[model samples]
Target: MSRKILRATYAPQPQGQLTMSEHRAAVKAVCVFPAGVYWGQSYGPRIVSGSNDGSLLIWDPETGVTNRIGQHEDLVNSVCIMPGARDRAPRIVSANRYHSVRVWCERTEGDWEWELVGQHKHFVLSVCVLPAADGEAPRIVSGTWDNKVLVWIKQLDGVWKSELVGIHEEDVRSVCVLPAAGSEAPRIVSASNDKTVRAWREQTEGVWESELVGIHEEDVHSVCVLLAAGSEAPRIISASNDKTVRAWRERGDDGWESELVGQHENLVRSVCVLPGAGGEAPRIVSGHDDHTVRVWRERGEDGWESELAGQHEHWINGVCVLPGAGGGVPRIVSGSEDKTVRVWREEAEGGWETGLARKHEDVVLSVCVLPAVGDGAPWIVSGHGDHSVRVWRERSESGWESMLVGQHEDVVSSVCVLPAADGEVPRIVSGTWDNKVLVWIKQLDRVWKSELVGIHEEDVRSVCVLPAAGSEAPRIVSASDEGMVLVWRAQSEGVWKSEVAGEHASRVSSVCVLPAVGDGAPRIISASNDETVRAWRERGDDGWESELVGQHESWVRSVCVLPGAGGEAPRIVSGSLDKTVRVWCEEQRKGWEEQICLQLDSSVSSLASYEHYILIAQGNQTVRVWLPDEDPEGQHMLWIKVPASPCDAIWNIDPQAGKLRKPEIIVGTSRGLATFTIEELPF
Candidate 1:
């Protein structure tokens, strides 16, 4: 007989009644940061990330290993990968609050080499690389706190040379290169805190001329070139702190005229164009402090209109739209201060939707929707504060609702709904601050029942359900603040369990069961504040042997097993307080080969995995869903923002179909019960 492997599906399960203890524990709030900034490769599958920690880390999107390239020695302000580098390894240029510019290179041996390339007399605010000139070395343009634009060019001798190009009368905030149509001598565009967009074109030989394109009364922060095929001229897009995005077109001679493209509810931070699909019209993607990424496309006859794309709970920082594979639809990737990266793709009918949210957890996150599944609408489930589990459901063509589930007595931390059970009601299990595990079930009469299992001596942190053993009832495992794994076995014919696994040293934070490993019995994996994940197997005569499989630098909060891809070896996913998620695979020589899968700018609290994506819930009350293979540039993923207070802890996330008879997101919050439905917003 062939063994069957079960893959986890996400949906909302009904919530049972809440206990007073659960309510009391749901007090602190989870907070999310800005949502727009995203990481992408201009050359390869590597991601360039700049952090408040004052370092620029280059990450391999495939392996998630990071190499610190440029050390700002202070808060690194911004980073950009240069375009059009063929022979040279990808170059990363970063600006710092310390008024310096650093360049980093990935050597042939894969190690990162860094150097302080240039120094600004004043704090450096932003940096960007231009499309290189034919046979000439690439140039990097930077904006300074002193309100100046400095251009650095690589000399023939392999040394970098710098020159003070054009000076903004006030602080320069961002610099971008707009490659001239059919020409290699690209033009430079700069935005300033002084409220202006300045355009510069390379004149005769080496001299550059500048002109004020559009004078915004408010500070301009970001700018990019929007390119389209068959067009003699490319449009320039600029975003400002004034909450508007404007487009500038060349008006005859060298002068440029500007028109207001659209307005945002909050400050605009970044903008980029989706590379055109051969004959398809070009689209523009914009990120804003409003925590949204709005995609605008030409309507063939009409100029341009906005498509919802998606919205985040925090401010948006950066966006990069990339051409898809094998003539597929184009994709847009964005990153934000909310600490995530999101990918979006266009449908056959030109409709835009979310792809996956990469679980990066960097601030300035952004999301793009992917194509909806067969007859199924895509939905987002988020766990937040307010002591409630909230779900957001998408309805009709343009409607959505938030639903609230009241169950936990205090802050609901994490939520996971078991896969649809055979001849059984779908169930949701939540870990909470009240040190108790609550199971929610819907009765045949359509009413919900919330039952408290035995209370944990400490906070119940995370939970997972094991696939039922042959003829055996399913079991639920809970991790607790006391560093222990409690396994509960079904007592009655229902999904409820009555027994405990009873093993550990400190608080067990996360638990997962591996898929059947050949004739071997299923194994349970648990991560703890003890900085280790222990794998346990049932031995003959009912005894068990538990061995430590992996170790971490700090508290391990979440654990998951990688679904088998036609392979028999076991692989597991674990997240830690050290802000990294690691994938552990067994090695013949070494006990285990641990590879970092994703790095978060902040601590990672919970994680869930789908066939092709991984969703990460953070300490900041934000969730990031990542696609590991879609973009070599690591530019594919989506970021979903949840509204939680800064200090609020996110316990769990369970994606399940609700007993309310609709797709729902059941999230545990620190305050009160909340539900987000595809039909209506939960108040």
Candidate 2:
């Protein structure tokens, strides 16, 4: 199936991340550097990240460009950029959970390649680059689950050799090298699962000695060093499973003391330091299991104040800062369990904002937001060209989650939610190109099951649930391309009986069940390619009959019934290929008469209504909301531009939920599904 990318930024929360498949792979590590540092092109700052899906990607945040550089055999645990001279091509070192560390570098021809540089007996959890001194090769330090830290130094012949640095009582969780001071040996800080942070200094040549720095109440998950400025010594920061981030500073004569920098509601997974400019205090950024990244800045006398930098739909695993270039504001990049590497930019007025990027594999054919089931969020149902039906629910943290509920033998053409019948559960009714209408319901075991309820001579084009009037069992109406409409009635023992309700001179295009008026029988409305809209009703023993409701200059593509304003007669709304919308109202003597006509720039593909608001999906890649009763001149019309041609749209509203709230519009396009709130549009 072809893949499509969608970006939504209508909500006030945060812009979304780069989303892949529904089974999202976790992003474990992220790092950022100057664009020209590793790649041949200069595109400002670039972000590189490793994911649990085994893929490594390089992203240019400014241009929204991405390149898959390499893949690993297992999930990558950590990543860091190799410090090198300006003339040398920088390499990215990544440690994976599969006991290996690899280096990725750009080739002479501008392509990318990777090679294994180090190996361990157990999975390596963290890796960092140590800058090379004069006449010496750069070294790489890695911490592993084997309870040891290993140093890999390149030899005179260009081969890398690994040696033991120090051992921890428990697994080493993270490691980082501090900035080298004048004539001082390199220092490395490692955090461990045993709740201790250790400081290792190169004694002579390659020999190293370790000393305990501090301890946390729980496992120390990550550690980093701030750059030393003026006369002050460098400070060490650590994130712990105890849900706190602490900074350790050296005392003149006494041992090191730790001060609480910030606290999270959940475990702090990773932490990094952004060196301050001039004499300002360095800012600390931490990622947490609560799916948030916070920036902590020292607010003299008030201690440290933290601002929410960004949020993920799942746990945040890693975070890094991209230094500002040419006086630009630094950007924060976060890797999340949601399988996305998000770029957060500082706004001019302070705070941060993100952009949305999502990918879907198949075209979405139809979408409908189900009636709110309970006090929780409402469920959204969609039909796809890949013969799959999916239901989406909003996650408590943020973002929407999807689940595959049903699979069909052919493309699902339409879908609608069916109200429950007596003690039966609510159902999802779908029509397919295979000439079948299937009813899906939640079984006692909580699994969804589908049953074939009706068959048509040709492809079923549309399906809608008939309004349940009084004690009558729930019914469904379906339209087919064979110029026929069928009604499926609920029978005893959960069985359904189908009967022909209407026939047209040409193929039927759409169908909608009208709301019951007073104590009258349920009515069905059908739009056909014969350029007419028809209403069907049962005349008791005379069976069902259809009569013309309105006509268009061209083939009618869609039809919807709108309740009369206040207590007036109901109205029929239709859209045609002739690029016009007409509203039909029942007159005392003239029967159904066209009361309002609107000319449009393009043909209307679909039509839906809630109250007096008419939603029109047009062929011109736009969706428009019209209030015909209030402003007929289109002064208050709201227009939305979509990336692709909109196929169908429906208002996500549930009156039974009580209390009025902002309604969202769910639109199915030839590419994917799009949803956004229709808040505060002028009536």
Candidate 3:
């Protein structure tokens, strides 16, 4: 028998930190949303997601890309594709705020053409296409905010027509059709905000009739139907705002009986059934409002005992299986109220083991891993509430060692290492809650040289190292709680000279340097609690003048510069507490055109970008990586999970250093530090 273990990157929270006062309590709590929702194939090459942004996207499980589709006008609420249909092209349908469902055909020439389908009387919220039956034309069932279920059938002339099949007192939220069981006609199940599930069955003569399955006592938000193997009866699972999932089965004599799958602690929102694979028992996946999704499977032969398969943080909004993608293992994809979509696959071994565990004095705010240089092992540097900085090193294959501790006197808010300066050993710089900045350098031995402090008068919030400018030594810039930006340049062998100070109306939250452009003056960009980003350049005369780059509806938490593509001006990317990542490109004449690159339904805590990928870390302990060109219109690039109880600050992804030779992500948590390597992740 194989052992099942959890392998997570864990860090221990620091001990002995001054507790935050009552007034600071409200300021410390954080809320996060899902990075983005994805929809795609159930197998190998899937369609990860399409959006209201008006674009369709295709995805390859091995590599992920963003902007996979082009654009849309309103919020895209739903998508569906007809499988194994005629014309060798899948019929795709999408719903939006306009109460319209548009259909598109994939042409043999590999292009997509869109056509307006029938319009709903109100906001079309969801849509699902049913499998064709008895050589009959395929059908589409859609639920609308108008509280009605609309069924569309293809006419003998090859055109489609719609009719109202059932009505509820409140909004109809979802609809799904059950596969045929035995000789019975297929059935359709609909969930509504009125707190009930309605089953519509095809009669002997092919006419549809509705019956109420009085299972849920609150708004029934989602419903799915499952057919058990070797069993003639089909099961109906419904999720409701009442915080429970109920499974109902139709008996041979025409009566329905239900049971509770009491796992979720909040409103159950979505449910999906996983068909048996390789003779294994079938399983059920459900999403809830309490920010969790529970997977349940039958335990024994009698099917009387049910056990949890797994759980995910955040309200699970949707779940589906990739038909042929997981090497016959069957994969499950889930969406959540947290604004993220996660893909889970069972390991060949029973399960994964949890990673490392550590602690912090205050919330371990920000974490970064220094790039590994030839033969040098990577190191994780963390800043915490105790106003201190600590360094953790991965010493061996399975061991982590603490190398340095206590570098600040107040909560250390940020940490970053400067790029190496001409053979000079790189130095570590930190910003603290005490409004001071500290720089550390290696001495004759491995001991840290005397810490240089007092660079700022207010709490230091963030720190960044600007790339080299001309022949000038690289400079370290720090953002502070006092809404100031302070620049320090290396003065002597080990000391830094404060060269400039600039101000804003609110606390500076994040800072980065724009990549140089053809002799252009190096510019420093900073995002603030003021909801604006300001760009500053060192004037040839030595004074700093500031220009407003753009504005966000909420606080901008992190900013990164995507390396230039083909000599194009480097794009500046920012993540905001407003639940969006905006990309700004400079126009030769217009200052900056802010393009809403991605709208993460959640607050984005941190962001990192390489030449090929952009990574966003959220408050939910998850990271999203996106490749720019695969699909221009899709929302998700790829979703990656972090260790438990994650921080609300910037984390680092060191794609270059790791035992597996693939990019490794280093995360700082409230407890300790952990590393996520590509080899450990399902590609």
Candidate 4:
């Protein structure tokens, strides 16, 4: 009954069937929690931060504007800026839990885009960038849970060149690029779950050599490099689960010396070096699960002084220092699990202040302002990769809390809110990978409980509910990959019964129920991988009438019935893997008519009809809203693009009772869902 909901936001991928690179590039924002903050080497006046939400937040304190860049489907753990020496691009490289790495850039129009340039076999935990020089490209280094360190370079032809620099028996958790001044070549350093730190130096183009610096007794999480005051030898600093930040100094060829910089009460998550000036040793900032940000500065040569820089309500996952950018002295930024991104500034009194609080949480899949739920406000519901669903209440427009609801053991396949009869409370039904259809109901105690119905043998792929046929309650029809369709209904005696429709030769992918017409029983229409769309009707004199309504050259994956006119034959519209949508209508009840195929350019993934409009979801990741009878020349009315291809969609165009605000359209993909409102259509 307890539902887990992810609140991350995902923008739409473009409508042009995008290549993998283009698809990752167009994401307007991913939901990174902003745990890692990278300071300089970026453009002027910008601080970029990374979070588990799979996006980077670029905060310009001068303008109070936060721009989000890049999008990954999983957790984004690390971010680093490529030094702006490259004239073609001032870029940011990030690593994510998807075991992939990406480079983000800005266009002349000031919009952000990303390219999936590379990755590792397991979660990509950390990334660092070495600046470009001598007309050569920058080096991108990444550490991964895959137990490997990878170095990435770009050729002049815009092709990515990569090499495996080192291998560890345990996870590589953090990576850092040493300042170019002190190494034979640009040196890249990594921290690992194997309790060791490894440094890799580029020997020649596309080649590297590695050596061990020091080992931690526990997992190491982050690493950063500091250039000494008068020496070319670099110092490496690290944070680890050992609850300490340690600095390692270079010895001879591969020898190193370690010094404990500071200690924390909990596990340290991230570390960054503050650029040193005049006579001070460069300071180090460390964030930890103890919810505190600490500064470590040298008291004497071997002694260190630790000060409290900031405190957060939750774990401080990342910390960084921002250069003045032609304003003032440097400032420190921290990202936390309490849904806040804050900064620490030094006051005129030489004391530190950490009151720069900003909320940079996950994205909101918006719902319309409604009166039914959310404390008489609109409530937003979202699905997460954790296979949990969350409903955000409207206490303050962004307010939400976790509550008990039906849950899916895997990613939820489908969600439908059944319209209740006689003004009763609505019920929610969800289909999932567990191959069961679960119905959630709210009890008198205001708690939600789930009732499971094992109807499908394989994953339950789609579900739809029909207007009351001969009964008062809506009839539920579900489709599945098991090649069967199920119909659930309530009997007059208050008992529920189910029927199995086994007409499909392959997987039944989508289902739609016909609205009631002139007292005749509402029919159920289903589409299947067998390359046909079939209509089923309850025959008063027999069991059921099954008719093959539409045929295609390939699999029929989506189907929707146009709202009939006062009990007329349902006009069935379907989309297929054949790159076209075909309409099937009965001509005087004898035969079905086929219209000229509309060109989609890719496989059609879904279809939905509402209020003089038919929305065709094509594999190009666009939802094209078409008007059947209207034309200027001939094109869609509006096209909406989403980050992922929409697998299903619905229109809540009908106004609900109690003056509830209705979301005009809700689009669904395999990984995310989005909703938008259109109060007035051009039609």
Q: Which is the leading candidate under TM-score?
A: 4
Alpha-carbon local distance difference test for all models? 0.61, 0.79, 0.64, 0.66
Per-residue CA lDDT of model 4 for 58-129, tens digit only, reads 654443334445446666787777755644556777788888889876542223557777857788877877
Instruction: Score residue 22 of candidate 4 by CA lDDT.
Output: 11
Error of 1 at 501 (Å): 43
Q: Between prediction 2 and prediction 4, which has the larger lDDT? A: 2
What is the alpha-carbon lDDT for the whole of candidate 1?
0.61
Roughly what TM-score does model 3 have, to 2 decimal places?
Answer: 0.48
lDDT of 3 by residue, 201-234 (tens): 8664446688877657788877887676674567
lDDT of 2 by residue, 117-186 (tens): 8789999999998878775668899999999998998877777899889999999999998776677766
Superior by lDDT: candidate 1 or candidate 3 = 3
Query: What is the TM-score ranking, best to worst?
Result: 4, 2, 3, 1
Identify the leading candidate in terms of lDDT: 2
RMSD of each: 16.0, 18.4, 13.8, 10.2
Model 3, C-alpha of 64: deviation from truth (Å): 34
